[model samples]
Target: MKRQLHSCALAALTLLSTLPAGAQHAEPVPSEQRVTVQGMKNASAWFKAESQHFVVYSDTSRASVFQLLNNLERLDYLLRLYTSAYGKPQPLESKLTLTFHKRPGALAQFADTPPRDAVGLYSSCSAGVQGAGVLLAPITELANAELSKAPVND
Candidate 1:
């Protein structure tokens, strides 16, 4: 009887070892790694803030969308402080549009000029229909070293 019990236990151990690593519980993919396809959210779906100070473009999810908005708001406040301390040649427009992309490659479609491998871009154009806005790449790409470390002023 003892010998049979030992054989059964060994068989069970062998069976468990043969199973795939995910047979028990698969690890969940991190949110940053689970990027959706580019342009998954259409331009029409962009959330407009109450102040119209800026518009958020992305399919990342409402929570992330709002977080960007808040960050922009804070950035604006900081800019105001700097301008007041120094002084601007002319008044600046408060309204803005932020284009947040799920992937770095997606920015090429919207760029008026050649796109860089930038993680984020604050850009504008002199004329010909390219307006002012900031383009944000995926959170995972934030540390890309190829692009300029400084933000593009336009």
Candidate 2:
């Protein structure tokens, strides 16, 4: 899993390098400077749980957190079985933190807004070169906002 993240970051950098330098905003920022969310808590003031894999940061009930973790464990197990080049398994090298919002619309926004029905995301990052990251929406609220602006059907 750690390998995959680095590979992804490297691949993205390579691709970005190919684009015209003028079109791409390539400002070299130090990793420490790029991390704004690091100091901030991922979950809200309510309902937080810390584990080896993640810190469940949200107001979600413990029951929901357990259910979510069960799903994540299943995913991790599947990911470990995933074969890369030469048939190597992609195991996670680090613990990941997850923050859940009760209302989908309450989730964070990105450069490209997420879908209203987005359930969750594995990760997120700033536009920094090093690919420092964190993970997962108020898309549902945005969706409702957009729907309110839609033209009424006959």
The best candidate by lDDT is 1
- Model 2 agreement with the true structure over 29-96: per-residue lDDT tens digits: 75421223456855234555656555565555556666666655655665566734446642754556
Candidate 2 lDDT score relative to the true structure = 0.52
lDDT against the true structure, per candidate, is 0.55, 0.52
lDDT accuracy of residue 151 in candidate 2: 50
Q: Which candidate wins on TM-score?
A: 1
Error of 1 at 40 (Å): 14
| Local accuracy of candidate 1 as per-residue lDDT tens digits, 1-60 | 999999999999999889566657769876442344576753344443423467655645
Stretches > 4 Å off in candidate 2? 1-45, 84-92, 108-112, 124-154
Q: Give TM per candidate.
A: 0.44, 0.42
| Residue-level lDDT for 40 in candidate 1 | 77
